[model samples]
Every structure is written in C-alpha cells, then in structure tokens.
Target: MIFNHFHDAYLYTLAEVYHKPQFYNQPRGNRSREVLNYTYGIESPIERICYVPERKTNIIFNFAEALWYLSGSNNLDFIHYYASNMSKYSADGRTLTGTAYGPKLFAYGDKRLNQWERIKEVLREDPDSKRAFLSIFDASEVLQLENIDVSCTIGLQFFIREGQLYMSSYMRANDAYRGMLSDVFSFTFLQELMATELGIEVGKYYHNVASVHIYETDYVQTKTVLSKAKQIGTVPAYPFPPMPLKDNRSDLQVVFEYEQQLRQGTITLKPVDIDRLDIDDYWKQVILLFAVYQSIQQKKVIDHTLYQKLIPLYQMLVQQKWESYFSIIMEEM
Candidate 1:
C-alpha cells in the first residue's frame, strides 16, 4: 500500500498487538539456538528473486480462493475438535481451558465477525484513529490442537493506517509460495470486510509472513510458484463483503450450523493452484525483510521472547553497513 520503505511497511504490520504475558514468561534463551536459522544463510529462501513469470492479480486471487475455502470450511472443524478436546472451564483466568468453549465461540458469524469484529469496533470507536489494532492470539485454543496434531492459526496481528488495514501473521512454519500467497489473500479480504462493516473506504491491504523460506523437499513446488509469480504482472483484489450477524449474537453456534450444511458427508476443500501466485510482487516482501532485520538489530529494547532468535542475526546484518539501496530493491525483489 503506498509505503515510503517496504521494510517499514512490513515491520509495522508485524508489530505485536496483544502479547499474552503468560506465554511471554518463559525462561530466556531456553531454546534460542533451536530457533536460529544460522545454517540457512541469506541466500536461502529469505533472499529476493529478481524475476518470476506469473500474473500478479491472478496469483493473489488464487490464494484468496484457497483461504476462503479453508476459513469457510476447516476452521469450524478445527474449532469443534478443539472444544471437544478440552471441554472444560476454569474459575481463574490463569488456567482457563477449553471448557469456556473459546473455539466454538470464536467460530460464530461465519468466522468473519469473531475475527474482524474487534477491528470494526476499533474503527467505529474512532473513525480517524490510525492505531486501530486487533489480533487472533488464542494460545489455549492453539495449544489444545497442538496436543493432538498441529495447530491451525499460530497468531494474527492487524493495524490501521490512513484508512487502510494492514495485517501480519507469524507462524512456526509455512509453505513458502503457497502459504504466503494464501495468507495475503485471506487477510486482504478480511481487511475489506472490516472496512465495509465500519462504514469506511478501503485503502491498502499490507501483509507479511515472517518466515518466507522453503524446506529442502518442497523446492520443486516453491520454484513453480516463483516462476508463475514472475509470469503474472499484477496482484488481484479480493472483494469480501461484510457478513450479516443474526440478531447481534456473538456466539459461534450459528456459524458452525451453517458450516455443517456446507460440509455434508465429506470435506473436500477447493484446491488452490500453486501457479496462481505472482512472484514479482514479492519484491516488496524482500525489502520488508531487510527492514525487519534492521529493526531487530537497532532495537535498543529487547524484552520480548518471540524475537530472541533474531537478535544475533540482526546484530550481524547491522554490522554490514547496508545502505539506502535497501529500499530501492523493494520494487526489484
């Protein structure tokens, strides 16, 4: 979205909105080395590719469609499974498990209202407030799912600037081109819906995925997405309208019921083609990475545990004496 520096744009979006202090209370450096990406140098997946062959807009939309299929479909199942697994509540907020039905509660209103409702509320509270923030950082829900197989949503963070909503998601892992593309599309749609609900005009929809690397095995799919992205010229815009709430109910039961009908006997989600992602537009992402790397280095206050692994790398990059060209490569990356 109209950024002075791509890195600035990316870091701002990645800012933490709601950090659960409990999760942050872990022992420092307990698992720092396990988190570092030292063996994987700058030339790894984090580096920017100069060229790709896909249409930008098509790639963005393809990812959007995939996200729609996932959110509208599996999200409810994730909620149900999580709720059933814990199935208990706690008197103290400290030990509150799934009994409170947080997953089921969050699934209501087509899964849009629960996620974007607070965003709209922030907008309505101050139509011109540039600092409107909201996030989906339900650790308890995610932990329950993690106990079984894998968690769905690692965490989400959103920010509003100049009437536009920007989002950033942090995950323990992602599917490079595929996951990043889908994430961008879904968050952009969510931004549009929140804007519509708040009665405000939509602006830019900025998005970022912290880890844009590839596994040794997924290189083939990753290369295909990159090649396709270079082929695409422009990114597609997803038009997501605001969801209608039934009598202002915040509970997720109604949403789950609707999902039940959508998923009759089998849950065959529409597959998102890897070719739909445009790699050329990802240049901005490369720019943002440099910026984040810089921020991590110059950061005087290092209080958060989430960024512990990045500190050493940040220190090394800062010593390189990188220059203004950092911003120029954004368009080329």
Candidate 2:
C-alpha cells in the first residue's frame, strides 16, 4: 500500500505486524521474536517524513547517521557520538564492519569503486539505464558471519523516468518499530539529494522489505505508538523547499568538517559559523540543530537566538502532534 508520509506507513505497519504471532530465532541466537514478511510504498517519501512522535526516534541521530553515510565515513568515534549503542555494533572496536553502508556504497573493497559516483555517471550518460544501482550488502563477509552486523539493506536502484528521479530500495530485513523510520529518513534523503544533483523533481520512493518484524522487547512501545496513532489525524505533507543551487557535496564537506571539530572540542558552534557555510538555509538549520543537540547532551546552555531561529522548523514537529518529542530539547533550552 502507498502512503503520503512515512509516519502513517510506519504506524500502519506496526498495527499490522504486531498481530502476527510467527516467532523466529534471531541470528545472534540470544532472542526469538515475532516476524512477518512485509512490503510498502511511500509516494512522497521526503514530505512529512520525520517520525518524532515515537519518542524513540532521535531526530539529531537520524540526521547525523545520514550525514555519516553520505560522507563515506566508518569512524566509530563519529557515529558513536550520535548513537552510543553503535559502539556495541562495532566489530573491531574502531570501525563498523559489514553494516558500514558508506564504505560499501562509496568505496567497496580494496579496488575502492565509488558506486554512488558511478551510479551518477551512469545516469548522466544514460538516463534510462537500468544498471544505475547502489549496492550495500557485502555477501562475502555476511555469508560467513553469524554474529556480526550484516547490512539490512541489500541495495537501491534508481530510475530517471518522465523527467523525475525515482528510487526503489530493497531490504532483506527491517525492524519495523526501531529501525524502519530511520532507514526511510536516510534513504529518502539520499534520493532527494540524487534528484537535486540530477536537476529533476523527486519522484516516488518504493520500499521493499523482505522481513518487517517487531521484537518482543519492543512490544510495549509499539503498542503505545499504535494507540497514539489512533488518536492522531493524518499529518499534512511538509512544504519542502526546492533544491538549492549550490553543490551539495561542497556543503556536505563543510558540515563534515564542523562535525569533526565539534567532536574534537576544537570548535564551538556559533551563529557566525552557520553564515560561513555556503550551504542552503535548510541545511544550515540542520547543522545548527546538530550543534544544539550536542550542547543539550553536554548540559551546556544553548544559544537562545539560534534556538529561536529553529522554532519554525520545530513547529513542523509540533504540527505532527510530536511537540512532546521537540519539548525534550526545549526543556533543556
């Protein structure tokens, strides 16, 4: 089924998947949970896509993870800051293994083939090419490992049809409650980015998950979200701004540099810092949001002016009736 926004699709999946009683043993062998094979399509994946009402969905971490993947980074220190639990997923305690989609997508193996760049080149050369696909799963390592972090996503295929860029993501598995929202956020952001680079309108996003399951541990939270879903009306689609004219790669590099400095405690994020970047206003706000999040994490006083500037964007979260989630940061400020 197709939905206008990711939140509706996710809640619908939770409501349906929770009823399936088919329990299966997880690969780690430590847990057995209910599982179901599910597939759904998102018509407007980038519009009204952030699912902050779940409480478990960390907006800052989601953005950070997307940036991390786009930057082709595998540094544990960088990712671990956004999600501390990511440290647990590290195989060598320094970098992520099979689950590092960045390395696999941008620089796979010793040959270091930049799959994303190649896909862009393919699309540029032949817009109708069916070979413009980005692969994430590394079978060579995943097939042998029973206890490692294997990629849940198999690959993503892009199609340029009718002057629009459409994306189809194939996933081997999806944790409906805990992982699906973030996955959609990251992938669709990439889709929009590609559409921008291709100088076309963003088209439909088709998500196919082989196994969409909610673990027994997340049952209570899932039920809470489902109940909330019933009380809330459908969220209106966000009025997404047009893609900026500036090169996104350059903007991403600037953001990555600031992020690194922030992590190293070498630079404190300030209002002037936002002006220094050549990125679009929206992305500058996103970068500022990250800086605010870091301040909140450290119990430091936030810049009230910057916080006020973010109010309009925060109002989007409130419009979705996710004000409580946004209040977490507001309370600190």
Candidate 3:
C-alpha cells in the first residue's frame, strides 16, 4: 500500500529481495532468493504499467496477455506468439492448463459456469458479499508433478465498498521481476474490468504472495534497474487511462478476432483505420497496440504520422524498447 503506482511497488519488492532475502529455493534448476508472505498495494490500479527504461518492460505482451485471459483462452500458440518463452510451460505442448487462468476464472467446474457473470450477480444481489471470489487453483489439477504450468494465482476476490470496486489477488508464489510485472498488469487490468462491469470506480489493488522472489538469473538486470531508480531519486508516474464505462464483455470476442488476425499476419490496420472502428476508444487503442506490435514483428516501417498515434506513454515505451527499428523510421523524417 506504500506505492501509488506499479513502478514503485515493483522497485520496492526488488530492493527488499535484493537487500534482505530471508530464504532461497530452486525450482526447475533456476535458483532464487525469496521473501515469504510478501504483500503490497497499488492505490491506482489502472496505473498498472511499469515504464522503467532499464528493464524495457513489454507493454504489448502485457496487454495481449490480459486480453487472452479475458477471452478465456488457454491456447499456447496464441500466447507464444507474443511471448515465445510461454511455450515452455505447456503441459501438453498445445495448451496451458494450470497457468492459464482464463478458463478457470470465466468458466470453471461441473456445469462450466460463467464465474464473472456470477460475481456480477453476486455483487448486484449483495454488494458486501465476500463470497465474490474467482478461483484459479484446483488441488486435483495442480497437485500432479507432470504438469509444468502451475498457476501463480490462487484466487481473486472483489469487494464493493463506498461505491468502489477493490480487488485482492492471492498467489502461492510470485517472481518479483518479470513475473510480478506481468502479474500486476494483468491482475489490475482484470480489477479495472470488474469495476467497469459493476459500474463502480476502480480502487486499490492488494497482492498477497506466499513466496515472492527474484530469480537468480535476473539478479544483474535487477541490480541495473535498481541503480537507475536510485539515480533518478523518484519513480515516475503516468496516468494510465481506465476502462470505458460500459459493459465491454460482448466486444471482447471482436477484439480477439482482430488480435488473431494481426497475430497471424493475415490482416493489418493503419492508425486511422483503428480510429474508424465502431468500438470505444479504449478498445480501439488496444487494437492499435496490436497493429504496432505487428509492425514490429513484420519489420514493417511505421512512419512518424502513424507512429505518433499511440498514447504518449505507449509511444515512449515502444520507441525505447525497439529503438533501432523506430530510429530508422524517425531518421527517414
């Protein structure tokens, strides 16, 4: 709860683990320094992206991954397109059963209930009901050793108090570097979405991790990030826009369709074309992000006119991460 944005919380977690790790554990041969029962809160859940230049966080993958979860998909090929490293976690080499919380959150158990709709109903029926929980961990499914894709999230609970929707996510384990970055982004994105569905304001995000750590492999990169922050003296903040105040569930399918098309390289859209789409500006920006990523992947040069169409924050991050590509485009000016 000490940080207003994701950036500070992330740095705090890293500094804590780096300075005073209480334990050590190695899972799948990658050793890590650990801190047990770690917790933090983001006062502004929609301000979810961590835009540190040193780490070069992938905003594109974070957005795509969040949409993937909302779409209730567990397809390895889909996620692997954005993050190829995700393919390694596939239990059957086709889908991610344990790690993919989409199906588990949206449709789970005997009759394949829509847990999100249920949560909305529960909240509408009784706003203060603590039973509004969307669970991801199933003992029988994740207990087996053969499964490599165990989910980091245990469950998410929603609370509606003072006309704001607050969310708390419970995780059995969290890797404080790359894992926390993506986890916080998606979880808070989900938090904001739930708030939109409930017609409430987005409140703070609470993350409680039983085991939080920075993997040994990321130690050097972690140190570099910390050094950059120390030199800067203050973590920067950005006003990440909130979800549109409308029920966007139906439009998710449309987004997924376009996302699939872009990811497959079968279709491309210009910035103007995205603006012309009938969807809300929020989703339009999402599609625009997909277009930007597609341009990067295909190495198709994007001109200044089109490149500047992204929100200033995204433009900053994209240009920073893919400087060479964008530099070529900018130099053409």
Candidate 4:
C-alpha cells in the first residue's frame, strides 16, 4: 500500500496480516501471520513514528538505535544499554555479526569496503545513477549458524529523479510489529542524511519485504493497538523535527562520547549542560534523551528538569511511555 504517513501504513499492514494473512508461518518456532512480498511507499519519511500508546513505542530507543547505526559501531556494550535483550543476537557475545549494519556500511567484512562513501561518490558523479546501491546482506552469511541474527535487509538503492532524492530498501524478512518501525526510522534517517549531503529535497521512501509477518508473541498487543486505533479517539500525529540540514555525521563522535557517559551514569546532566553541548539543538535533544535515560538507569525516574527540555513532540512520546511517573512529576511541581 502507498501511504501518506508511517502511522497509517503501520496500522494497515498490522491489521491486514492479522485479519487476512497470505499464510501462517513459523520460520523459527515462533508462529506468525505472514504476507509474502509485502511492500509499501511512504510519502513523508519524517513521519516515521507510530504513536500508539498500546505499542509503547520507545522514541528514545529509535533515536539511540539510529545513532548506533550512524556511528558505524557494532559494540554490544553500546546497544545493550537501550535493549538489554539484544545481547542474545550477538554472535560472539561482544559484537553483532549480522544485526549490526555499521561495519558493513563503513568498512565491510574481510575486504573492508566503505559502501557509504562509494554510494556518495556514485550519486555525486552521476545523480541519475541506478548503480547508487548499498548491499547489507553478505553472501558469506549463508554459512552462519542457526538462531543467530542475520540481516533482514537485502540492500538499499538511491534514486535521484527531477532533483529529489528517493530511496528504496529491500528486506529478506521483517517483523511487522516492532522491527519494522525501528528499521523504517533508521533507513529513512539514512535517506534524509544522504539527501542533506547531496543538498536535494528528500522524496518518497519505498520499503519492500520478501516476508512481512507479525509473530504470535505480539498477537495480543497487536489487537489492543488496533482496537485503540479503531476506537473513537486515537493519538494524533505530531510534528517531528526534521534532521538538521548540516551534515552532522562528523559531530556524532561528541554525541557518542556523552551518550557513553550517560549510559555509564558517569555524569548527571541538567538541561543547561545539554544546552551547552558542542552540537546543534537537533543533536542536543538526542543527548537530552540520553540524559533522561541516565536518570532511569541511575534513579529509575524521569528527571523533571531534563524532561522539560524535550520538544513537545518528544514530550508526548516520552509521557506516553512513562505516564505514571510523568503524572506524579506534574503533580509534585
């Protein structure tokens, strides 16, 4: 289906497979409602968030995970902080072999090919080049053992048409419930970063999956989210900040540094400290998110002071995730 916003696409796809699946599948002992060759086109890539409260979408993890990919890192220590269970997917319990796209994006296995730079040069030299593609799944991965994390993505292709930059991602398989949301958040962010680097307007995002399915584990929650979505009142789409025009990839190091300190509970950040970060407000907001997570790590409560620093869109997302605590803080103040 072609969709105007990610929310609509998410709800439609989830409901579709639930109500009428092409087939029921158990790829690895987990039963799922599946649809083969499921595909979608998003008109506004920036509207990537699915604000359903039942889903408890973690905006912080979305941003942090995107940063993890952008930083070209495969460190388990870094990602494990956001989603502790992700450690299970690690091949050697340290760095992720298939799940981590950073190494492949920057310096791929064995040959150490920098696909990121190659894609940039490809599009820079010829805007209309169909060859501007990046491969994520390595052929050698076929030999990897079972139950390990393998890349769901096939590759990403960039198209420059009529001065707008569009991207398409092909995935071998995707878990429609949770994984698809994060994957879309990261890939579209990649699409915009490339567009910003090329100084072109961002265009539509095409997501094609060989098997798009929802696992049995999420069936109950899926119904709740859909039921709420179809209810009389539902969450409204908010204005998510666009990626800063600056090619801020170089500044990611600073972001990562502070993120490490936050994750380690090494330093407590006030709103003022976040404001003074040597980065744009767009990025400072991300650091502020880390600082808030720091509070949860060290104190298990959202810091009211730092929580006020978030933009209203983010405030809404965070509030939904930690509603009980958010209300108590509101009452105390």
Whichever of 1 and 4 has more lDDT, that candidate is 4
Considering only N, C-alpha and C atoms within 3 Å, which residue pairs clash in candidate 3?
1-41
In Å, residue 195's CA in model 1 sits off its true spot by 1.2
Q: Per-residue lDDT tens digits of candidate 1, residues 1-333? A: 344322223222222111111122112222110111111111111111112222122222232233333343433333332133322223232333332223322353345445445555665676655444443334545453233333333454555556655444445443333344444444444444455455444454433333333333444544454445445432212122223322212222332332333233232111121113232222222222223332333442221222222233332232232334344434544
Q: At residue 143, what lDDT does model 2 achieve?
A: 58
Global lDDT scores for all candidate models: 0.34, 0.75, 0.84, 0.86
TM-score of 2: 0.89
* Best-to-worst TM-score order: 4, 3, 2, 1
By lDDT, the candidates rank as 4, 3, 2, 1
Clashes of 4: 0
Error of 1 at 48 (Å): 20
Q: What is the C-alpha RMSD of each candidate to the true structure, in Å?
A: 18.2, 3.1, 1.7, 1.7
Q: How much RMSD separates candidate 3 from the native structure? A: 1.7
